[model samples]
Target: MIDLRSDTVTRPSAEMRRVMFEAPVGDDVWGDDPSVTHLEHYLAERTGKAAALFLPSGTQSNLVALLSHCQRGDEYLVDQQAHTYRLEGGGAAVLGGIQPQPLDGLNTGELPLAKLKAAIKPVDPHFARTRLLTLENTFHGQVLDADHVAQTTALAREQGLATHLDGARIGNAAAASGSSLEALCAPFDTVSICCSKGLGAPMGSVLVGPEAFIATATRWRKVVGGGLRQVGSMAAACEYALDHHLPQLIQDHEKAERLAAGLAAIDGITVTAQATNMVFVAFEDSAFAPEPLHAWLAEQGILVGALYAPRFVTHRDVSMADIDQVVAAFRDYFQRLTR
Candidate 1:
């Protein structure tokens, strides 16, 4: 089946597997795993950060970042729709006692500067002190504007707030905007780069930042049960992805553009948004219902994310031919409705 549900579904290639199999291993908690240590250092150098820590997942990376930045009673400002705020299971609040001040944001996934400035507590005992400002790049596959990021981070700095970036798909953002990873990540104090997404690693995310901040995140990671033993193989997979799969993100974006264009031409479909490997579409006209399209596509050996408003993701695992098959299936479904 051609899986368009998410980039996370991509499996490691034989070459990546071979690299993992040959990787040397040691206990990561003791900071002695060569593969894990190399992966962390590589990511840190690429992002121009002082240090990096490998974690099990992006959610843990973000949670550890928040824990490192904020104290028990402090809060962080984030967009309501951001994965760190909405989709990450409230780990920061549940585990770290951090409060989240979620604000409405633009369709671009940026929090309004005025609202952010207004949300900071005035050193009062009545409110949770806003300690950090968090943002997600490639928010729903859309790259955050560079200027917007600079301005937001500057605002946070001026307000005496630390900043963190949930850069799970920063590779896609960098590829789409022609920006270097260092340039893209420079504005934030800390960033979480997920290797399991479009990069095609089986699992892992590296959190990079200043040495002191990374020290704090490391402790938090251990406290949160992220201290894995002999994870050199998984770390090797992530390192391999950085070398081999990171460059392919551009092709994923191109495929999304083609898929969006194809679906937009169909009579009963509205192309809602397309960016950095993701294409979202809405079914138009009351004559056709989107509910059954899920099963229909499944029968055709195609898969998408949502049932009603579908989100089709293009990844290393999905070829251009698969994109054409998806477009043909949508065209056939709409044509049958009209007939």
Candidate 2:
């Protein structure tokens, strides 16, 4: 099936699998895995961070970063709709006792600087001390303005709070915004980038930050069962994705745009949003049941998520031909309504 559910459904290319098979292996928890070490160093240099840690997932990377930055009872400011806050299973609060101070972010995934100022709790025993300000680079496929990041982090510093970025789709943001990863990450104290998503790796995420902070996250990683033995295979796949598949995300974004345009022309379809490699769309027909579309699309060898506004994701596995097929399927579904 042509899966448009998420980029996370991506499989490593054959070339990536070859590298994974050939990668040198050692226990990562002991800091002896050469492949893992190489991957970490590569990402650190790319993002201009002093150190990096390879984790099993972006969720683990973000959680470890949170544990490293905030102590028990400390709060981190985040967007109400951000993955680090609303998603990721609340690992920060569950594992680190870190509280989240969620504020509504702008359409560009930026919190108003004034709202941030108002949200900061006065220094007192009664309030959860704000310790970090976390941001997502691509909030629901919309790239956050890089200028907004610099300004927000600068304000976060003035408030004596550290900053972290849940950059799970940072590569997508980089491609869409035409900004270097270093420029996007420069203002944040820590940043996590996932290779398992749009980058087409089997599984892995790299969390980059200062050496001291990474050291703290290291302990938390082990505590939370992220320390892996012989993890070079996964690390190698992620590294290969960085070298190969990262550039192709721009193509995925183009496909999403193509899909969006086609969906917009349909009489009963509402195109809510489109950015990077994701498209949000809804059926305008009052009698339109998403389940029927789901079943119909499945019959057409297409797969999508069951969201209120169905979200479509483009990835390496989806070709221009496949995108055309999806558009055709949707057109067929709607055209049947006329008859």
Candidate 3:
């Protein structure tokens, strides 16, 4: 089946598998895994950070970053819709005792500066001290403006708060916006880069920050049961993705644009948003049932997101030919409605 559910669904390519098989292995929990160390160093240099730590998932990476930046009872400012605050299972609050001060964000995924300034609690015993300000790039596939990111993060510094970026899809943001990874990351003190997403690695995320902060995160990672043994193969796969698949992100974004344009031309479908490698579409009429379309598309050897909101993600495994087929399938589904 042609899966458009998410980029995370991508399996390792034959080349990546070969690298994983040949990778030199050692116990990562002991900091002796050469492959894991290589991956960490590569990402650290690319993002211009002093050091990096490899974690099992983006969730853990973000959680560790939060734990390193904030102490118990301290809070962080984040957008209400940010993946770190809303989607990461609240690990910061549950595990680190860190509170989240969620503010509504603009369409570009930027926190309104006025509201952000007003939200920072003054020095008092009554409020949770704001310790960090977190931001996300490529929020719902829309790239956050670089200028806005600089401004918000600068404001964060002015208020004496540290900054972290849930850059799970930072590569996509860089590819789409024509910005360098280091340039995009310069505003924040720490960043979590997920290789499992558009990079097409089977699994792995690297958290990059200062050496001292990474040392702190390493301890939290161990405390949270993230200290894996012999993960060299996974690290090798992520390295392979960084070397081979990063350029393909631009092609994925192009395919998403193509798919969005095709669906928009259909009579009953509305293209609600398109950015990077993700496109969201919806039926023009709320009364329309999507169950039939889901079943029909499945019968045609196609798969999409199971959620009520229709989101299609283009990835390395999805080709231009496959994108055309998906567009035809959607068009055919709607054409049958009029008949």
* Model 3, span 270-318: residue lDDT tens: 9999999999887888899988899999999999886488899999899
Best by lDDT: 1
Per-residue CA lDDT of candidate 2, range 164-259, in tens? 999999999888878888888898999999999899988889999999999999999999999999999999999899888887789999999999
In model 3, state the lDDT of residue 223: 97
Candidate 1 local lDDT, 127-209, one digit each (tens): 99899999998999999999999999999999999999999999999999999999999999999999998999999999999
Instruction: Show model 2 residue runs off by greater than 4 Å.
Output: none
* Per-candidate TM-score against the hidden true structure: 0.98, 0.98, 0.98
Query: After superposition on all CA atoms, what RMSD does each candidate show versus the true structure?
Result: 1.0, 0.9, 0.9
What candidate 3 gets wrong by more than 4 Å, as runs, is none
Give the per-residue Cα lDDT of candidate 3 at 183: 93
TM-score of 1: 0.98
lDDT scores in order: 0.93, 0.91, 0.92
Model 1: lDDT equals: 0.93
